[model samples]
Target: MIGIENIIFLIVAALGIGLFVWQIRKIRKNVLLGRDVELADNPSERINKTLLVAFGQQKMFKRMLPAVLHLFVYVGFIVINIEVLEILIDGIFGTHRVLGFVGPLYSGLMALNEILAALVIIACVMFLWRRNVTKVPRLATGVEMRAWPKVDANIILVVEIVLMLALFVFNIADMKRVLLAGEEVVGLYPVSQFFVDIFGEDPEQLYIIAKVGWWFHILGILAFMNYLPSSKHFHIIMAFPNVYYSKLLPKGKFTTNPAITHEIKAMLDPSYQPPAPEVDAEGNPVMQRFGAKDVEDLTWKQLMDSYTCTECGRCTSVCPANLTGKLLSPRKIIMDTRDRMEEKGEHPAIFAPNHYKELGVERVETTDEKTLLRGYITPEELWACTTCNACVESCPVNIDQVSTIMDLRRYLVLEESAAPASLNAMFTNIENNGAPWAFPASDRFNWADELYVPSKN
Candidate 1:
């Protein structure tokens, strides 16, 4: 019973899904290239946080106008996709309105979908206007936003508009076709009904237009699916898991290195002993690096954070260092991480050959000397951060930008001994005087002594 059109649809669907899955797998492999860290504690709390931050979009409400517009696009796009299921069924079985058998329920669903599609088109237009016409400072002015990032944003918005248009065209043409045949239209087309006259009363012409629109809509969805992995729109999928695994600790609390903590403990207590070093596959002892010199040194969650970034620039807009004209932009930091990951991903053999070598399989070597720290992100940018969690609080997805910054700082200080001059002095004071002040511990109470007289009451 299968027709040529149905067979072609099946092949295209299979190919699209296969390509999407392959890219997703590659992204997973890249994310897993980072060191592992446990974030599984408090599962219930994490789920609640995910619902509030990702699903509820609580953090985005800080800026009301964009929030409302984004909500329209977000909700409309998702709800409208219910029609994609019907489209899929119709495409595969070569049936017209396959879900039309649902009777009046189908009418209600179609009406709702038509309304949402219209809203989505409106939202996407406003979004485009904001980016191009209004030139919103945060969205427009970042070094990272130049060229491809800007183009990518516009592409997604325009694509959404076109897809919504295609839906309307398909509906209008189908309604015209039904009317021409003197058959009862199965579904309500509130938005499309107004435009049905545009296609004329020619049944064959309506049929062709309907088929074209249907094909374009489904094909566009498949193309958009594959494009997500390379676009900031990936956050649509990544945000939930990223928010779920986000740090639950207080913003001001910094995570200390376990090795450094053990060393401090040993120094403070004569009876304390450090834990034994981890051993490799051959029983050779493995030493831990001080901090993140590259993406591999960062936690997998941090890498996911990079991929999940919406590039909204809310974080950068709130950043004190950037406001003061410093080299640091929190948005840039995340973008750089993602760029570095992509660079490394392209040359898997040079960075991640152990897996292949272990399996006795050879991979081509593509040598590149770049690293996340010096190559993509600079030392000045890392040091410019004030350790304030303003960026963290501003992020809609709850990306821990500060944590990544701190890890890079740790690598600079512990591994390279490259802390800033002022910080180096403070470190010396802490070591010799047990405080950040330059005065020795013996003189610590001198100011208090001067204030305290032999006052006997």
Candidate 2:
């Protein structure tokens, strides 16, 4: 019972969905390349946080105007997708307005969709103006925003505008077609009704226009789905899980290295013995590094944070180090992490030998020997952080930018002994004098000696 058009639709849909799945799998593999860390505690709290931050857009309200506009676009994008389901059903079976059978309910849904589509168009236009004309500092500034990132934002906004317009054109033309046939229009077209007369009463012309608009809208959705992985808009899918797995501890609390803790314990108690080093599958002991020198050294959640970044620049805008004319930008740090991951991901032989062998390609050493530490992020940037957690608090998606900064600092201090000269002096004082001061512990109370009054019983 399938027509040629229905068969072609099936083929195109399969190709589009299959390509998206493949890219998603590749991204999943890249994220899992990092070391594992347990984040399975406090399930109920995690869910509530996810709902508030991701679904409720709680953090986005800090800026009122953009938040309101974003809400229109966000809600409209999601709610309008319900109509896509009906489109899919019609496309597969070669039926016309199949959901129109729902009678009054269908009319109500169509009316709502029309209004939302109009709102989305307006919101997207305003967003485009902000980016191009007004040049919002957070959205426009940043070395990362200069080239492709800038173009990508504009492209998405323009695409959204075109898609909404296509929806209106499709509705208006279809209404005209129904009227020409002397049949009652199935769905209400509040927004589209004004444009219904644009396409003359010619039956053939209305049918062609309607078909073009419908095809353009649906095809645009599929293309947009595939584009998400490569675009910053991937946050739409990654934000929920990223927020759920966010760090729950106090911002000032830093995670200490277990290897260092074990060493300290051994120094205090001679009877204490540290655990044995982990071995590989071949029984060779794995050499563990102290801190993250590369993406593989970071936790899986940290890598996920990289991909989940919305590039909204909220973190960078609030970064004290950046505001004070320092080389550090928290947004740049996260973007660098993602860039490194993508660089490594491109070379399958570097990560997966088995897969590379299956492809019948010769295993060759990569010419680029750059690492995430020196190549992507500089030492100056890592040391500039005040550890204020301003970036973490400002992030709409709960990305822990400070944690990554701390981990990089740990690598420099513990592994390379590369802490700045001032910090080295403090470390020596703490080791020898039990404090950050050069004086002995016995003289610590000397400052209060003048005002001291011993308790007399």
Candidate 3:
């Protein structure tokens, strides 16, 4: 016979799962709105990258103190979740300590979980101190880290502490129940043992405490799962796949647009033939825009990178232009992309829908118009980048902020012809003289003449 508790548990679990799945679907849809990119070249290398970078937290170790603290939290999140399996089973069947049948091994696992949970609480506290007390420069006071991003970071740390505390309370109360029943305690509750003394020897009272703690802890996990899709904390889930699909080419290497490459080749070789236009499913030639003017113009991986951003500001901290007081903040570039993506998802016609309609697209233009280029990020910020790859090297999640900046620059220069006067002059010089200087190709050796090698002899 099924009990009311089991039925209620099933309903709540079903609702949580359903909501989480829906959020995942929405995120997938938003990411797919971007242009298709092929990153399927190397399978083994991808797997190795995911393991080394994501699982190993290789990049994070560059900051040793934070890395150690983060390792504790990360390991605790994985190891302590083992108890959640037992919680699920117990919830569904209305059984107590079902895994306790594994005897000493079960007790050992419980002890390990308790120790890890305590460590997680401690780590979270240190993380908060690092953010608030230490005031790390890298975790800047910019608009990117202000508002909801700031609150979200603190909330996650507080939530972890709360969850870990609940686990200890549950274990302590459970131990009290064992004492009252005159049964030998099963698990080695080292940290929770102190709690047993506080709660005292009443089985009935302890049982109530245990149930409350258990319910809160399990429900907290479910709530945390659903919260992930909407928060920067989504990196907890996205990091694995993001690192797997990371750019395998050298960090300094920039991706060339195939369309522009083809055009240049055609110019260089008279015999070169242009490829046929890309056709949609209905066989109509699809017009592809060059570079990223909006979120939808970026590659899906770039969109994914935005969501995976931890907002740590490591990229912005290392950015040479930002250090030089330029407008560019690599962190903001990613945050802006995410903000624009979410804005468009919510408002739909936030971008110039009328423009899309005039081009014969299905989307209709609306009065509310915005774009990533000017609305969320400015051309000033875009052009400030030095293309130094410092941001890429500093990123813990392998987010290629430089690539995103380059794509926006490409859209501005190639599509809109919106380059600054100096850049325009440089482009003209490159076109005519085959150099960035205004001098003719004949003057290419002029700089070499300035350097005297007679001293070497």
Candidate 4:
């Protein structure tokens, strides 16, 4: 048998280095996949952001039941790791049971851990059955589901299965330990005691069982550690920044029409991108995002927003367009943007027509029939959008589906000159007159039609 201290040192070093290298490589790959956003460079600020979002779980309250369940599971994690300390002690001395000053500390911890472990196990059971048995839209997935088509959901499903099942079985073993030994130095771990009372004396194999259980426990952890990088659980890394760097501004406050506050200005070009430097006679920047028709058209931050979506479909559930039976699913919109970005990965920007043919698809650009017919999305889905921010409001990750919709709208209006007749005419009239309705001012509101309604002074 190896010395306890040597084993402890080896495992800790392995875990630390393995996790570090794996996560670093994963993050670099994701960044290469168009996830570019600059967080504050200051150390304290970065630390603060990490703590509030990743640890604090600030935005996760939207789904209270799952949020609370996940919160308890996280606490359970801290508890179970305490047993690792006991293992280290045993590694140095050849026995894992607590001894000396920290003996009581660990014993008490084992009892607490046993209790939390039971709760965690129960929650896991409920969660698993809920996902597999219940037809909840979020969890009701079959072989055909995906955040992206080429992306396989099986990778994530398998990882989640391993992680949750390991926790479940590992906890059952800990409970067995607490129950088999009567009046252990550890206090009451009710669930185990309750179960053990149901099964007659089993003290004969307690120590052997503990050793076997511990081995399985460690192996399960090793598996999880190694598998972290290659799965959709990649969110485990992305979620940290996703929350910390979430949008602080309100939903409706998305953008102002380059609010023309200044009384005097000169140039006014509708095609202008940086309208501020090129503000017209009214001092308005014109909010010139003629819309993201292609991946390159998105801002670096917007690309980050795409990767951050959890594919949970909470956004789709609340979208007015989907509810009214319109083909527009906001969740689908965010999902497709992410998909297209992946399809275009590392490829230099070229006219869509020229490049898509290289990939064995007839549709290269958004204007093509394959794309318009919803190569990845349906046209009915496009027109169903009401431009409401409900999806944006509910998302914990600040995924700006509304902005994406506006960008597509911009592409249709400015590039294809296509839209619902009313909206198309409105756009034309906006160019013809200061507002959408281009009716003569003399006929406005039955005379004296020179009235403007500005809410602020």
Best by TM-score, which number?
2
Best candidate (score: lDDT): 1
List TM-scores for all candidates, in order.
Answer: 0.92, 0.92, 0.91, 0.66
Q: Rank the candidates by TM-score, best first.
A: 2, 1, 3, 4
Q: Give per-residue CA lDDT, model 3, range 1-457, as digits (tens).
A: 4599789988999999898888888788888878898998899999999998999999999989989998999998888878999999999999887788889899888888988888899999998998889988876465456556777789899999998988888898988888778898876777888767777677788888898899899899999888887677889988988888899999878887777878889999989998987899999998877878899999999998988998888888878888887778899889878878877873211122113223442222212248887766778888888899999998888998988999999999889999999999999999999999888899788877757566764
Report every candidate's CA lDDT: 0.86, 0.86, 0.83, 0.56
Candidate 1 vs. true structure, TM-score: 0.92
Comparing candidate 1 with candidate 2, which one achieves the higher TM-score?
2
What's the true lDDT of residue 235 in model 3?
93
lDDT of 1 by residue, 1-457 (tens): 5699999999999999898888888889889988889999999999999999999999999999999889988888777878898888888988888888898999999999998888888889999999999999999986567567888899999999999999998999999999889999998989998898999888999999999999999999999998888888899999999999999999999887787888899999989989997788999997778889889999999999988998999999999999988878899888878878877874221121212122332221212347778766678889999989999999999999999999988999989999889999999999998999888798877777647568798
- Distance from true location, Cα of 396 in model 4, Å: 3.0
Candidate 1: worst-modelled 10 consecutive residues by lDDT: 348-357
Q: How much is 125 displaced in model 3, in angstroms?
A: 1.0
Better-scoring candidate (lDDT), 1 or 4: 1
lDDT by residue for model 4 (103-169), tens = 6565576577766776676666666655557746654531113333213333444444454444344
Alpha carbon lDDT of residue 388, candidate 3? 92
Question: What's the lDDT for candidate 3?
Answer: 0.83
Runs in model 4 deviating more than 4 A are: 1-20, 32-63, 78-105, 141-190, 193-208, 226-232, 255-290, 294-296, 340-382, 412-421, 442-457
lDDT of 2 at 363: 24
